[model samples]
Target chain A: AQTIHQWPVAEIKAVGSPLSLGCTIKGKSSPNLYWYWQATGGTLQQLFYSITVGQVESVVQLNLSASRPKDDQFILSTEKLLLSHSGFYLCAWSPTGVEQYFGPGTRLTVL
Target chain B: QQQVRQSPQSLTVWEGETAILNCSYEDSTFNYFPWYQQFPGEGPALLISIRSVSDKKEDGRFTIFFNKREKKLSLHITDSQPGDSATYFCAASAGGTNTGKLTFGDGTVLTVKP
Candidate 1:
């Protein structure tokens, strides 16, 4: 079975602070990776997706960027945090042309 | 504009009853529909899904009814239990793109009383 892990389960940061969240998938090789964000009582928004290592596509511009430095690892980062950036960030992986499997997710609060 | 929409922002039902959730989308290119269940502080999990080619899909107590002409789909939870209480999200995707990226609705919170 495959398992996905996300780091820093939760975080509280002040505005203008830098932030970085990581996700790693085990037992799956060459899988597609995606990043999604959901605000409190809001719909889930797709941020970025990557089909292969070192290449990522932006689905929506939230002033955040994603990198897939390794086959099993995906990283979401930002240089400055805004109040609107506070939300639950989810990392997902999927085989080509199938539904995605989401990670535990990271809760971020920007003050 | 929001491409996907779900009705009854919240729902409550007694155990053993049936719970129905409605969803609709605007994009004709969306050929795949999925319903996800999420507990507090957890990621949404795929509960059931239906392709545009099919009108319905079922998994045990969960069933999805799709109306391709209306661009609408619904999830039916039969014999609802307390464990079924959670926020359910309706999502749509364009399978032809093969991106595996889904567009999600605002979600419906279901509460099943024992």
Candidate 2:
């Protein structure tokens, strides 16, 4: 079975502060990765997706960026945090880019 | 514009009753549809899915009815249980270069009472 792990289950930061969240998938090699954000009681919005290492595509310009540093790891980061950036961030992996499996998620609170 | 849409932002049903959730999309190229179940804090889980080529798909108590011409689909949950309460999201995706990127609906919150 494959397991996806996300770091810093939760975080609280002030505006203008930098933030970084990480995700790692075990048991899957070179799987496609994606990042998504969901506001409180709101729908999900796809932020970025990476099909291979060092190549990431932005689905929506939320002013955030992502990197696939390794085959099993994907990172989401920002130099400055916006009030609107505070939300539940999810990391997902797809074996065939059709049916995706999501991780536990990271809760970010921008103060 | 939102490519995918779901009706009845919220729903309530009694145990043993059937609960239906509807979804529709505007893009004709979208060939895949998947429904996800999410709790308050956890990530969404892929509950079931259907392809445009098929009119219907079923898995145990869950069924998906697809209409390719109308660009519509629906998820039906039979014998609803209280445990089924959660936010259900309808998602659509197309093949080719944009494959696997899903556009999700706002979602429907379902409550099943015993």
Candidate 3:
């Protein structure tokens, strides 16, 4: 069985602060990784996706970037945070294009 | 523009009643559709999915009805239970793209009364 883990279950930061979130997948090698953001009462938006290590594609620009430094690791970070950056961030992995399994997710609050 | 849309921002039903949730997409290239269920503070979980090749897909009490011509799909939950209450999101993806990025709807909150 495959399991996904996300770090820093929750975070509260002030505007202009830097932020970083991490995700890891166990029991699956070379799985596709994705980052998603959802605002309160809003739709889930795809932010970035990675097919292989050291390469990531931006689906939407929100001043955030992602990198897959390892086969089982994905990191999402920002140099500067804005009030609008607060939301629920999700990490998902899929072996194929058919279905995706999401991690526990991280709740972010920007003040 | 939103590529995917879901109707009835919220729904309420009594236990054992049938609950219907409607979803539509604008991209004809979208061949795979999946419905996700999310509780108050958890990540969305895949509930059921249907491919354009089929008109309907069922898993136990959950069923997905797909209308390719109308570009519409719906999720039907039978014998609803209070534990079924949650926010349901409809998502679509163009398969074989490698990216597998999904476009999601605003979601419909379902409240099943016991």
Best by lDDT: 3
The top-ranked prediction according to TM-score is 3
Deviation in Å, model 2, residue A96 alpha carbon? 0.6
Candidate 1: where are CA atoms >4 Å away?
none
When candidate 3 is compared with the true two-chain complex, its DockQ is 0.85
TM-score for chain B of each model, two decimals? 0.97, 0.96, 0.99
DockQ, all candidates in order:
0.73, 0.70, 0.85
With candidate 2 superimposed using the best TM-score fit, by how many Å does residue B80's alpha carbon deviate from the native? 0.3
Worst 10 residues of 2 chain B by lDDT: B92-101
Better of 1 and 3 by DockQ: 3
Over A1-111, each residue of candidate 3 has an lDDT whose tens digit, in order, gives: 999999989999999999999999999999999999999878899999999999999999999999999999999999999999999999999998569989999999999
Q: Please tell me the TM-score of chain B in candidate 1 relative to the true structure's chain B.
A: 0.97
Model 1 per-residue lDDT tens digits across residues A1-111: 999999989999999999999999999999999999999777789899999999899999998999999999999999999999999999999977568888999999999
Instruction: List pairs with backbone clashes in candidate 2.
Output: A97-B100
Q: By the lDDT metric, which is better: model 2 or model 3?
A: 3
Give the C-alpha lDDT of model 2: 0.93
Report the poorest 10 consecutive residues by lDDT, candidate 2 chain A.
Answer: A40-49
